[model samples]
Target: MKIVEKKNFKYVDYLWDEAKAATLEGNEVDLLLYRSNLLGTDLRITNYGGGNTSCRTVEKDPLTGEETGIMWIKGSGGDIGSLTRSGLAGLYVDKLRALKKVYRGIEHEDEMVALFNHCIYDLDSKAPSIDTPLHGLLPFKHIDHLHPDALIAVAAAKDSRKVTREIWGDSMGWVPWQRPGFDLGLQIEKCLAENPGIRGIVLGSHGLFTWGDTAYECYINSLEVIEMASEYIEKKIAGNGGVVFGGEKIKSLEPGKRKSQAAAIAPLLRGLCSSEKRMIGHFTDADRVLQYINSNDLERLAPMGTSCPDHFLRTKIQPLILPLEAGADLSDTTKLLGKLEPAFEQYRAEYREYYESCKHDNSPAIRDSNPVVILWPGVGMFTFAKNKQTARVASEFYVNAINVMRGAEAISEYTSLPRQEAFDIEYWLLEEAKLQRMPKEKPLSRKVALVTGATGGIGKAIADKLVEEGANVVLTDLDAELLKEAEGTYGKDEVSAVVCNVTGAADVEGAFRQACLGFGGVDIIVHSAGLAISKPLEETTEKDWQLLQDVLVKGQFLLAQSGVDIMRKQGLGGDIVSIASKNGLVAGPNNVGYGTAKAAQQHMTRLLAAELGPDKIRVNTVNPDGVIVGSKIWEGAWAEGRARAYGITVEELPAHYAKRNLLHEIIRPEDIANGVYALLGILDKSTGNTINVDGGMANAFVR
Candidate 1:
């Protein structure tokens, strides 16, 4: 929210003019390059990555004047600092525009899985930016989107709309946040259908988005809208403005001094940059710059974090809050590094805790997080990279966030992201796909897996983990949450979680229909979902036996039945992970329905492996006895069931089970996920096989 300092404002306007002029001259490449650089400058005065700028070029058909209209989209993976023209992919404009016109359909579960794959393009990097088409929808050649901290402060607030409405009036349109891509594009197209010549859009609970016939016009419109918003809010607060003053009337350092400083700083870092050293400029004293230095509550006043989600390519997460106290020393660079080291540690720890709680595998360890870069207070930010490209990308984001923070305090506050959603986006499939496309260390990418009771716990884990390994996964469970969560991870494209009462004949038929839609056919289905109940012979009810039969017997037959059909169609073989207890292999006292059902489930798996050998699906079961964490088979259920047979307390159970396993290690859900991946990827050709994901418990089953 801080007003641009008169001096700094001039610098900003200068860069803006230079960028706009380039675009006005019909230099698309220069337009993009200029905006990218100006945007970097603007970001330094705000919070990290507080905003982004994009340009849409209308490429035409070779023979016709009509628009072939291919859009060279900013490929999703690269940061703007080092964003390369080569990374831009030509999107078929007609197809995307047509997609924008369609209404959202009530899609089938498996159908959604198929659709997610279709979203990819020949660029074959990560999925295209969900907003690529949205940007293309704008007729303007240039678009500027900002999460100006000041604007968001007033905007993200409950009454932000009133403030924005008061400021923007009929000048801009507003849209609510929806799932990005087709649905969102449809909504935007609907709105634009009515207001064809609109200039900008202010997304509710999001940020300011501006557009123009040219890049300069776009940048100016954005500045005008933001300035008006800032002025309106400043007056509404009943103050002329936050009164502030200049720095130590430090004699206007000569232009010669500016050149010397810019020269010194550029060379110090240029050796680390990728490509050749390009343009270099330095900011001298500016009015907003002074306001930024003198602004009160520097800590809380800064933009919350990012100006926009896309801004991550520029300003990272947070900025180094420089102390502008009178007589303060700006030369003490080490002090800035000292304050950051601890905060970085805390950030990594929180990140680790989040990873462990969500990651299905305990097998693959956490990555190093020493700090992507450092924020040096008065000196601005510096990136840490063995190479210049990454270091500069880090620096670009660092500055953008700072500028966003600078603007944010004026309006009120700009929200970054909610904690959980941040984690989801931070690890989103579109984000993860970049890693997936890279040559993997192991040859597991093409594996296909079938996981049962995949709607929850062990089954879901096995299913999702398989997808990360570059495998297509089929998950079966009666719960819809499995699909919801899985879709949240794999975008409903690479992973399918179906609701099937595995006990029913018709339902199993439906599950295979889903698999066909998911990956064209089936390769693996882990019969991981089943149930357990405990009671002595007299206490056990007939209802328990009936329920158990539906799952352990009938359900197995139906699921195996459908899978065989798909495997036959596929002709290529697959793997099946059946989760059975140690009691099924041998016997545990008082174990009635579960022991019998698992015994039946295993025999059926072997039976299918035998029957389907000609079609090529390998059927197997991971007989894990006591892997309690993250499986549908809850410890309480296992405890009560085990105690019924042994007459022991539930509290004494983990210990009791540990006594039976040879390795004395608890079977984690990750261990089960590992087993699922292993079974699918292993070269073993044998069918009707069993892998004991259990840590040596099968050896202890002497009976």
Candidate 2:
């Protein structure tokens, strides 16, 4: 981690400009956007995907069987920040253009992916970029590409043409931003034909697309255009005079708790490239405090995500508001989704209608407009995707995207492309296939995770998430009805549910045996079922302590040993995630047996990590605070009574625990679920540690 001086910043900036400028010097031009095309290939622009860059090369040589010219682009999985010459892959430009013309008789994405995968590249370092075809349609040699907020703001707005007319006027052309791929190339070609001598193009609701005769020209044009839009927005917004009055205060959520919340949110924000680290803002200022507490403006302002296109991919339209009764804290998964899923439907219906009215031709429906991302109150935005990579990417883009939109909207109304126009780009045939053809990795897909007490609150959610990732899952619980309900929830054959008393060694062993028989071999295990009995030392019984131990400590040991045995046989280290609780760290008023059992659970979690480290198995514990509020535990008035007896409202209880830390977020089942997922090699880094699931609880320190 290093910081460059403000003065030094210009040089790095100039270097990218120079690189883009240098490309056009030898009749070889790299788009100026390639210079600093995207922030990085992390959780920013393209998820775990690489951003693209290219130059037009004349393959019109008379040597052998020379055919057509090509668009050389950044290969798959390469980052845009440090793009080298070898990073770009070459594709026949004419062939790419041909893809769009045959609209009715177009190829599905899978076929095209297969075709490109076979295309010869200079080397492995250069794989085909996802946007190669889109680049081919633009005649300019140096084109700069980026999903800049300044540009996206204009794109997502309703009157892109009107907005551009007010700014650059005749100097630029406003094309409704479409999804990136071949269809967009065709659209660009058609639009270009309509207007000659256009150097810059604004894709509504997406980003800015600009090209120039030279890299410097292209770079200058991009900077000028972005600054113009951003400057205009700044000027207008300053006049609006944002929310005023004294800034509200927020309680702190601690470092360990902050990390847990980030982990909890990581899975949902898969497509958006964001790090789980942003959950550390336990102590923010007035604006954050206001936005944190009151989400009334979310629908009118940040609804369905950014007003424009790419933001839709990341933020997914809007944030789920925290219910009033939630007491400014969210602890249950159901309350979060109970509020989340309905709004999603409202947007989905509109989506279906948008496609129905202006469907140009039969395109195999746009990727399940199922809304890829979600933002929750208390918890930061959660981008939903099948994998961690997708979620992180979505979250990163969304944070900045949302911030920029909020700022820009303050100045003027946000506008964007009409529904039909947005659809064409989203379902672009060429881009769709390019992604499908990517080589698959075996480290994750096909791996199995057996989660104990998985039919319960936290365990059930974790099992569901893993199944979403295409993992083989074995769901076990002592409650047959709960497990049966879980079987219904997950769909038949996707997961196997077995009734087992984990405290009984044979029952635990039998469940493992059954899972092995069902899914071949197991690679990950999560021990989550436990008892939390809160009573005074005076009222405590020997049976109470024993009951807690039988369920919490004993269950975790038996499950981990079984997972270890199965993993060893498969010649791979397995992952073991134990769901501990906040009581483990901080003692509450009368939770004697519960607190002791939880503390013991944490020790066992660490001991397993140390023992399994030698065998390559990674073990970690997820200690969540205030999660019972959203679980069946709360439905039965257990959490409510617990909160009442403690002299606090149930709403205040989660925050009492959360405000004790740095990030003031309540622990949710999904948060605990996400932490377990991280330990299971979803991140593929670090080993042997206990990660908290509290939203920044201050003193529950574990190292």
Candidate 3:
């Protein structure tokens, strides 16, 4: 429970040096950056973008030697771990603090936002954190505000005041739950004025605020406070068996079984969670998460409230407890999918009622009523968000809350702010306004897509375009190594790669299942997997024809059928774009196998379009010509053979082919990708049609 000394910490020197180099004029800004980064680097202290830090420093006018006191604080929506000079915004200290004196109660959100922005030292600087005024009113030179999990255990407890005294012994001041804004700032300033002896403040059901003359002191204070709270909980919960109440001991969810269940159930939940505004679900069977969600009293204890009020902004007040049996139906995907919608509907109805009960005339617009965090029996838990990072962020905080609640309950009964307070924090002007600051989502922001042959030129280009248009992609390819590389390029969340042999039913089905697991369900399918062969009628080998038919023809058929099944289960009409070739429309010597397979694939697209049109599913094709760049198919033997057939060297193939076309431009993979994207969703009413991407080849103009 002791503070980590500066000499004992290994990274302190490197961090301090880095902070000093980033400072403007090498002042206390170095201290602000150093201390803030130290606090942020530890997930035990604060999660991503969850806390704020500030310093009261002198801003020297370079032109005039006049020194003005300016408050430099963490800017809104900036992460503290990678914070730099730009992450810290400077505001006129007097102007910020003067609001305490001149403020009449301004209850409107816009008016308060305007007032805060007006106090900035310069409009050009990044916007100050909403908690800027709280730091300004405090007399300390340096301030650290953090939402440490251990602190939440104590601050969110029913006997928070008693626990606060037991942990810090009057060293910290206590304030009841108040949503973060001007009123909260005034209340904090009042608490400090009332308790002049306290060095820090414990915000009930919120976070901790500590300050010092030196940066090291403020940082150490937070560490020491957190360590003490952590120790207190550890001791209280020492040798505690699973909560045994009324002579019934909570059973353990066997780790091995829980993990298997989580993997099996995740895909179904993912598919169920998918909607018009797409959400990606992530599965976790972390020991802490399982221990809590599977506990005997979860039905009574879990839904009380969040571990802290601040978390309500991210995780809502409580998680949706999915009605999943512990052992039965754990591995049944169809059963889980069948039950998912009803469970979600019930959760939504209850959430809406909760909102209605607590809302006032001036409440902000309600966010998604669906619970972001879902907990089940042996399946552990799932978190759904717009993307993986956000889902992970929520999961991390939720895990922290679980540990905090475990500690609080071990000590005594765990409790948080009442419904009204929780509602206030959720709809508070400053917190709600953060949503408005987020960048606008693209049209396909919540949609998911699955693409075959995604490691190759046209396939990879199509995947990238879909991502740029705001769709989450599931990429399938025959080359496992190449698919892995492609997956790494777009980060963990945007694209997932599955090694798939499209001609094999098992592989195709597995690929579709993976698409469901990765992004709930596939809304758009681009079947780009194909093979080409060069052989004249006389030289054509049966083996060459079989290979072409297997990959170019059979592959499309398998992928289209599997993807359509997923779309049908989702009950959302989807787009299926087949990447047929320009060769399909035009006959050429030594290209019989390829041209024939492609022609059959195009015909299959038409059949699929006619069959699925009744179900509102659209089918289309993109016929791309000689795309040489990023094409492994054209770079080796195929390049030499095509060049030889055209009576030219391989080096002249690109320009020679380009000139034969009306536009005289060499078609790139991106050109084919654009056509594919247009067919997928952009051309909403267009289906059973081929969009040629051949730079204007009249012979390949769908004749």
Candidates' C-alpha lDDT: 0.54, 0.59, 0.77
Candidate with maximal TM-score: 3
lDDT of 1: 0.54
The model with the greatest lDDT is 3
Give the total clashing residue pairs for model 3: 2
Quote the positional error of residue 695 for candidate 1 in Å: 2.4
Best-to-worst TM-score order: 3, 2, 1
Q: Model 3 scores what on Cα lDDT?
A: 0.77
Q: TM-scores across all candidates? A: 0.42, 0.50, 0.90
Cα lDDT of model 2 by residue, 205-263, tens digit: 66667776555565566556766776676666556554411122233354344334433
Candidate 1 vs candidate 3: the lDDT winner is: 3
Q: How many clashes show up in model 1? A: 53
Cα distance off (Å), candidate 1, residue 39 = 17
Candidate 3 runs further than 4 Å off: 1-27, 61-65, 105-111, 239-276, 326-338, 430-432, 478-481
1-703: candidate 3 lDDT, tens digit per residue: 1223443332122233433434534468876887787778877788788889988878775546789888888888887777888887888888788876666664643355467677777556677766877788888888888888878778888899888988888789999877677777888899999989797999887888988776766776667677778777777766475452111324545867665555556555655565434576666777677677766767887688685755766777788888767676544456666677788888778888988999989799777777788888655678888876777778888887786677678767788678888887788766667778799987677678889889888889999999988888989998888988898889657888888998899998888777655555678888888666666778788988898899888888888887777677666678889999888899887788889998998999899999999877999989888888777678676787688778889889889879999999999999988897777657889879999998999988775
